[model samples]
Target: MYLLIASDLDGTLLLPGDTFGAFTKSVIHSLNRAGHHIVLATGRHQTDVESLLDSQSLPVHLITSNGARISSACGGLALSEELPASVVRTLIEETREDTDLTINLYCQSGWLMNREDRNLRDFSQNPGFQPTICATENLPLSTVQKVFFFQRNKDHQALTRLQARLEQRLGSQISTVFTFAWCLEVMTRDVSKGNALRQLADFLNVPIQACIAFGDGMNDADMLAGVGKGVLMGNAHTELFQALPDAEVIGPCTDEAVAHYLSKHLLQSTALPA
Candidate 1:
């Protein structure tokens, strides 16, 4: 039996509009009661993740900022990784000179953005947290968790080209991945959902094979490949499907596939056959 259930928030656990249905909530509560640990592994910041789960308190371990930060279910920071000051400075300077992308930096204290455009405003509203507007050079780089680049024109091809260029320039100094169509995330090279999950499993004294995960983005590829039973949502990126071809495929997130899968498989069955 799996000891832990880790799920990505945006497109796997929560639906398109960042809403968590009652059915899903109830299932998670049941799982918690049944002695299974529940984890919310997301590309979001800690504040954003907490805001989304507002009022409805559940014991959910958080792996936020695509795994740059980890906190206990009760909201205590357990582990956090920060990008080097030099790296952050260089990246910010390069981004300013090389691209028209709207950039946001997440620190341990709060989110920082240079301007409040329509896209940034919409994103802020969704997360229910406003960013502190500040110059890129003035950001608190010592505690930087993650840097996000948002496409103003929403051109997938252009974003792809930019990502490639940034990766080539940054090389192994940073890790870059796309969490959404118009967004690219960069973090410390050591950070990833897989590494965070492994750390959490160690903290809980649970083996890696006793964990299960679900996700649907390129940022989630490492996590999906690392878990014992990595389930990909039907609406997942084609690249994810191609990369993890052997992973189980479930219905779309809007259909409450995680809830249904849990109900029919993990909850109902005694254990997965050897």
Candidate 2:
């Protein structure tokens, strides 16, 4: 049987403000040697993800921009989905009416922002790539892959209201998902980690039932449910548990749960009979 191992980056594989630890990297190398595909599915852009890896030579597939783009481990683009230009214009117009909202647009090239908002300032510090300050109207709307709305503080109510408004207005034209309490991600309606994983599996000639995924956010729900085995981090959002009660639970990402779980279970397991 062909097996695929897919995992989220932040809050799932790596702890807050941390990268892959030594033991985790060693185990990933072992998994790769053992003939399993490793994939990094994240809300980050491809450039950001690559920067985070630095000189690390891990052959890992990438599902980036919250699945707005998918690339092979060798850096071949497999899929690229962008929100409609009309929808982008509408979002910019409506969101400009809200003083509390700070928007960042991500394209295949890099990040773009209309103003130097405090939230953008904080994000730029560790975003791996800096956002180019430009007018929203000047952005390459046709090439935009994803849009991020960040609100200051943990204003959950404001985010919820914005999400509701966007969903109501855009309807089936776009996809909106909250990646954090104060952040909402907007992409094409067809973009999702789950869909990206499925596409990658098909391209690699691996069955869906041979895939396993690990994650900790609401955005990960579809991916967890779509895979053969879905492992939830112990510190996962409450909504994830409510959405996937049957998913296997593991220790928090801070504890290097992924390494431990792989060493104890998957790495030692034998392939099923053909």
Q: In order, what is each prediction's RMSD in angstroms?
A: 2.0, 2.3
Off by over 4 Å in 2: 75-77, 120-127, 271-274
lDDT of all the models against the reference?
A: 0.84, 0.84
After best superposition, candidate 2 residue 89: deviation in angstroms? 0.5
lDDT string, candidate 1, 1-274, tens digits: 8888899987788876778888899889888988899999998898888888887787799999999999977544488989989888877876775446777899988888876556764454464767888876676778999988888776678778877877888889899888877888899997999999999988888898899899999888999888888999998999899999988899999999998888777778877542
Q: lDDT, candidate 1, residue 183?
A: 82
TM-score of each: 0.92, 0.93
Q: Candidate 1 — what's its lDDT?
A: 0.84
Best candidate per TM-score, number? 2
